[model samples]
Target: MEALTLTTPALLFSAVSLILLAYTNRFLGYASLVRQLYEKLKANPDQVLLDQIMNLRKRLYLIKNMQLLGVASLMFCVLSMFLIYIEVFLPAAYAFGLGLLLLIISLLLSGWEIKISVRALDLHLNDMEHFSEDNS
Candidate 1:
């Protein structure tokens, strides 16, 4: 019987794989929320609700991109891990580094998305103010 020795890159790849999968699930949940918001807006396109719809749409786009990136990164990590196990192809360090880069890219997209969503909500708030004034 031989004991298997896992390299640092292999360990990192496994960690990234798990993290990316979790992120994908979280993004999917966000997508579902956006879908629900869209359905609600379809029923009633009031000024406030319309604003929320717009905000949710922006968030949805961001989440979609994030999910796509996470999936890509996860796939690459899995492939890299398999290659490492087989002891063929490039170094494990390269694989781990690339995976980390992809995760960072996704995180950056998520941050930008949060900023855009906040701006959208602010715009909706202004619309609400205008609607109230018009009613008064």
Candidate 2:
């Protein structure tokens, strides 16, 4: 294995920062939707609305976890840089590897959340189709 350099861990800074930004945007969007849904549910309780809320709840959980992991990955990268700075090569390598692993896991969870989002959209489309048929 090659010796870990400070530059190696520094490389992740921009990528991870962008990812965290995206995650924050997603979280904010969900928060807005949750508020809207809450008002709707309060006005007239429906199973479809309940289901949507449940789906949102799950997505929100996933997003939270993804953000957590992403932040942890960034932390590890920083640690790796610090270790390398202190000339502890082996542990620096290990920290960098762990950071990469955490990043991969975070990305996987983001993909899973996207799948759920697509499914929710499909469900909404199905409902729209049913409503159109009834009106027709």
State the C-alpha lDDT per candidate.
0.70, 0.95
Q: Which candidate is the best by lDDT?
A: 2
The number of residue pairs in model 1 that clash at the backbone is 0
Query: Residues 1-136, candidate 1, lDDT per residue (tens digit)?
Result: 2332345446655666676676667667767877787787788767867666666677777777787777777666666667768875555446655776887888898789879867876886887899999999
Q: What is the C-alpha RMSD of each candidate to the true structure, in Å?
A: 5.3, 0.8
- TM-score on alpha carbons, each prediction: 0.63, 0.97
lDDT of 2 at 33: 99
lDDT of 2 by residue, 1-136 (tens): 5666788889996799899999999999999999999999999999999999999999999999999999999999999999999899899888889999999999999999999999999999999999999999
Minimum summed lDDT over a 10-residue window in model 1 is located at 1-10
Candidate 1 Cα misplacement greater than 4 A, ranges: 1-7, 10-32, 35-43, 89-91, 120-136
Enumerate residue pairs that collide in model 2: none
